[model samples]
Target: MERDRISLTVPTHTDSPAQQVVQYAQNKDPPSRPLQNRLRKTLFIAMPPKKRQSDVVRRKSRQSDVQPGDPIPNRGKRRYRPGTVALREIRRYQNGTDLLLRRLPFSRLVREIAESVRPRGEAMRWQSQAIQALQEAAEAFLVHLFEDTNLCAIHAKRVTIMQKDIQLARRIRGVWGGLG
Candidate 1:
């Protein structure tokens, strides 16, 4: 098997700024170079052979440049947008399981929904447990939506989730009685 090697000549002078930079860059090793007052010493290092093409990364091919007159091919499905990284991150953060225990921003909306469900004549002030329960339920709902949508996207061999993925997730999760 072939091996790679690198050799560097280093000076032992303590006053040279370039030698100081090299010393700082490789601080883990002791200065084993010959300490001759006037002569420089050579340092030999052995490195492993270069990796094969299979060991190196294989990146996706970029789209070819198209002229204005070129007609785009008709792929049945529309491609996902690449610029929604922040939106996906926010969705994941909002759907985090920890949010179920903490206060949710939509707690007020939950309270209003609760108020609407109550009988018209009676005044009902929501208790802390009721609000907490509503918040937890909302969090669970969001988590389910995000998780199901992610699964739907993965099922279609896509990294980015599209609107169709969400719609399919809603159907699979029986959000609207599985009409689809």
Candidate 2:
């Protein structure tokens, strides 16, 4: 029976005598069948050699046109500075009233809540003026609650408002129940 063999060849560029000796020994004794199989598997899966960082060439971007000390031109959307209103926000403020709550939906919700609480035989109806007043009060209450919740989160050195922060805010405001 003819046995299958695999040979390992070392690079000729190796100048060291020790490397040459090792190469000769490797060539003299071919790898066993299992070792040859492992080598074949590894060869198939082996990744290509990575290029050194020093050898890599970076292409110049448009910013290269500017001198070393000069500022690079802003190419895209400009960011709003602190306390500066965006153009869209300014347009929105001009186009609509500054009220956060929409009257129609809020009034509907208020009427629904009142109807749910009233006795079955009794009817509940809200005046336009009363609904407007309720909407304003609800908006103010919500804004204050959110501000307090945000402050609580800030106090805890966190940027995100959590359920605990809201509960703490409600506790401070003397409100009884939260989402819990």
Candidate 3:
């Protein structure tokens, strides 16, 4: 019995490269679905199933069950009227009635300075009212100095208050000569 042998060689083409490319492209199988649809199908298969609304567990708190018209149950802590203290303090500060610096530190600093400047062998004592008055005065002076410095900075077309701005402010106020 004689067996027939088939040739497994690529056929030689006399066609141009562009024509061959077109022929090769035409011979290739087209996608059944769009690229986006294929990707969506693959992602859907890879993703876990989503929980339904009934399947999801929700926390039920006392606050959540309360209606808008109902009064809030007190937890034994004192609660102030909203914005009362904050707004009052802001207004006091704006009107130059409130002290900006902390009381304890300012009083300590004033005491130390007073002690250092006092005559040797002399004892110095300050009343609470005197210390409070001193702190208020110092804070007011500082606020005024800061305002002047800020003006100097603004004049120099800068937002930041630099040492130069402070120096300029002090010079303008005639206080630069004695301090330096």
For 51-160, candidate 2 gives per-residue lDDT tens digits of: 66644443244445566888767799887885467556767755875677777888888988898899787888778889888877777677678888999999999988
Per-residue lDDT tens digits for candidate 1, residues 28-94, read: 4645656564343444445657667654433212223555678878878765587587788888876
Task: Supply the global lDDT for candidate 3.
Answer: 0.66
lDDT at 57 for candidate 2?
40
Tell me which residue pairs clash in candidate 3: none
TM-scores, all candidates, are 0.40, 0.45, 0.46
Error of 3 at 106 (Å): 0.9
lDDT of 3 by residue, 1-180 (tens): 233332221223334545534554467543354444322111111345566665444433544777799886778977789889888976887987667788988888887888899988898888999998877766767778888888999999997899999888888789433322
lDDT of 2 at 94: 59
Candidates ranked by TM-score, best first? 3, 2, 1
The per-prediction tally of clashing pairs is 0, 0, 0
Candidate number that wins on lDDT, 1 or 3: 3
